[model samples]
Target: MEQEKMNLKLDMDVQKLETKKLRKGKHKAEEDLKSLKTDYKKLRLSMRTVGLGKTLEQWCQEIQEEKIKVGRWERKFQAAQMQNRSLENSLSESQNERDELKARVAELEKTVHQYRNRNSVVELKASFGRIEQMKRTVEELEMALQNCEAKIEYLEANDDHQSEQLHYFQDQVTKRDHIMGEAVV
Candidate 1:
């Protein structure tokens, strides 16, 4: 009977030890699972951050490229403006020269009339030659004036076309800026 009691006690102690070991192993597994879950959450957050960073960098590069394009357009517009002003100045100078030539021709015509009434033969011949020369000069001046007028017209048309182009570019830039604003929002 005593031997039977000792064997029963030994079996009870083994069962207790096995139960404690199983509880410890279960606790360790739970801790390991919690740690793995925390690590996964951190990795997901880092991935999101990296994605956002790449998106921001791409946006910045696009903005910089847009700025460069705008700068080039502005420079072209300014150059066109300067060219228009120069053409205007040239047109003014040509008009002034035409007016002066017309005045001189009128004065020559009056002198020719006075010479025609004189009776000296040699003086009459000289006056006739001078009149012919003056007429040729007047014709040449008229032709030059006409050419200047045509050039002025061409320049004015060109300036109008350039102005239209500049407005179109400005509108495009404005639209791009609006789009970017919406995207950022």
Candidate 2:
């Protein structure tokens, strides 16, 4: 009877651990889904700016250009994120490492907060010079994203306009041909 009770207790402990892991997995999956949705929204919006009337080749070229531009910024963003993670992990490992990491984290956190909480461009300019650099980089990325979108829209709009013009000219040519045929007959 004593052994049976111990076995049941162990089984319950195993079940609890499994449940905890399952819950963690579910949470991570949800986070990934949300991140993917944001990325998809940005991607679809960027692609839609490209127009239908453009030749397949031109559309392809535009897509490649967009990809290159986005890829560069993404690499920079990813590198920053990775560095932050490494700092975090090092902080978690030992007392000495933790103190050094904590100080680094504190400095960065202060800088980020200062930049984020600034109410005016003037205040930001006076407070954090690196903040200006970060803002400039962000603005450049936003402009690149916008320009790529505009290029796609221009291609599509021009294609539609040209298509309508082509159809009109085609009708006129057909009408002239028919008239010539009738007159000749």
Quantify all predictions' global Cα lDDT against the true fold.
0.76, 0.63
lDDT of 1 at 35: 100
lDDT tens string, model 1, 1-185?
99999999999999999999999999999999999999999987776554443476787997798789778777876777777677677767767876776777677667667777765678767766776776777677677767767776776787688778878877988887676555644
What would the per-residue lDDT of candidate 2 be over residues 1-185, giving only the tens digit for each residue?
Answer: 99999999999999999999999999999999999999998876665543233568975886687568556655654655565455444434444443554555567557667776765567556546654555555455555555555654565565566556656755865686566445644
User: What's the true lDDT of residue 52 in model 1?
Assistant: 40
Best-fitting candidate, measured by TM-score?
1
**Residue 39 displacement in candidate 2 (angstroms):** 71
Compared with the true structure, the alpha-carbon lDDT of candidate 2 equals: 0.63
Give, for candidate 2, the lowest lDDT window spanning 10 residues: 89-98
Query: Which whole-number lDDT from 0 to 100 does residue 22 have in model 2?
Result: 100
